[model samples]
Target: MHDFKSNPQFQKLQGKKVLVTGGAGFIGSNLCEALLDLGVLVVCLDNFATGHKHNIEEFLGNDRFTLIEGDIRNLETCQKACNGVDFVLHEAALGSVPRSINDPITTNEVNISGFLNMLVAARDNGVKRFIYAASSSTYGDSKELPKVEDRIGKPLSPYAITKYVNELYADIFHKTYGLDTIGLRYFNVFGPKQDPNGAYAAVIPLFIKKLMNHESPVINGDGSYSRDFTYIDNVILMNLLCLTTENQQALNQVYNTAVGDRTTLVQLTELIKKYLSGYDPAISKVEIVNGPNRRGDIPHSLASVEKAMEMLGYEATHSIDKGIDKAVKWYVENQHSF
Candidate 1:
């Protein structure tokens, strides 16, 4: 969507084979679509535990797109998906802090054990680079503003601990196994195809869906909590950079994939209302309710994109305002599908 063809660096990915784990989920599905557009062979490995079928229905017919209905928890499945792949974009993981807190065992099994399986599979199969979806939750309880890669606090939830373990495993893989790896520590990524229905739904999509139905959307706290709400397209760019960049200094490093800006929960809701109002003016009048802040919730989360920009030549094409407009439009048009 960002005219990826304009970048000569990305041109190198044409005709390459890529395996995107969790390819039926929000971020993974979007990545699959983008790679197919570049004429890259895409193998989507998903178990559909959290991923939806319709998310990948469109790509199912593409000759270049292959879907492997399997779970990463199975080393054999991961081994099969990694075979003949040029690079691995590992996006599979059980997301959400509350969900992890609800059942830490399942989360660990998928996020940690599953991740190790993929790493071993990729290493054994000679995959060129293994790029993974890391989380801002890895910052944990750290109150530092504009989180940098070098600085991090202790993990606050089981989900955060699993993601931090991903970073550790990746580093060890690079050091001991000689597998190229890059960890993209994503902020609050939201966009089209993001599931709005579920107990562990993200704030943006959940708020958008409630407001669209004129339902009262509840905030976890007094609405002072903030996040570096990043758009999906910007995230896509970060992955493409990690996949194709030949910069030796960039490999085996963790970069914050974000807009480098923060928006409060209250501000985010207002912006969503402002954009959705264009389609249904009544949405602007929806009421927001306050509830007790959930445990393991961070008060504020922001990112420093300096590492990405300097090493990967990355630039965020969408700010929060621009991204919200596009996402609201998508949800409005696709509401009937939901």
Candidate 2:
């Protein structure tokens, strides 16, 4: 979307064999698609615990795209997926603070143990780089505005703890095993193919689905809490930069992957309603109800994308408004798939 073909680093990605863990999930599926577009051979490893088969169904017929139905928790599965892969984009994990709180054991088993398995497999197989999906939740109770990479606070939730542990493990792997790694700490990412159904669905797609169905969407608080609502394409660009950057300073470091902007829940709902109304006028009148804020919910979250810009030449191609418009259009066109 950002003229990737023009970037020489991106040009180097062509014909490389890359393995994407959790390639059937929302973000992973999107990554797989972007890599395939650049003529990169993609091997997707997904257990489908949360990832949907429908997400990667389109790529099933592509010769360059291979999907391995396996779990990262199993060392052998990770080893098999990493075999002959040039790079690894690890996106598998149990996401959601509330869900992790409900079952910390499974979250730890997957996010921490599975992550370790992948790292060991990558190291054993001689993969050049391992780029992972880190979380802004790792910021935890830090009341910091525009979160920077070096500064972090104590984790608040089980999910947050697991993600923070990932950064630690990755750094250790680089220092001890010489496995080149980069962790992209993603903020509240949202866009097409993101699931809107489930107890732990993210706010954007969940709100979009509710508004489309003319159901009253609940706001967790007074709708004042905000997030650095990032578009999927922006995330894709960051992953490409992580995969292709030649700078030694950029490797084995964590960077925030966000647009350096924030939008309140109130503003987000208005934007969604405004866009969806074009497809169905009834969406304009969808009710928004306020509920008590849940435990461990951050009041506000933003990111400093300066590090990514300075180090990787990363630039966000879409603002929240533009991203919402595109996402709403997709949902409208494919509402029957839900």
Best model per lDDT:
1
Report the alpha-carbon TM-score of model 2 versus the true structure.
Answer: 0.99
Report the lDDT of model 1 for residue 82. Answer: 96
Question: What would the TM-scores of all predictions be?
Answer: 0.99, 0.99
Q: What is the C-alpha lDDT of each candidate?
A: 0.95, 0.94
**Mind giving the per-residue lDDT tens digits that candidate 1 earns over 306-329?**
999999999999999999999998
lDDT of 2 by residue, 197-226 (tens): 999999999999998889989999999999
Clashes of 1: 0
List candidate 1 stretches off by more than 4 Å. Answer: none
Error of 1 at 128 (Å): 0.6
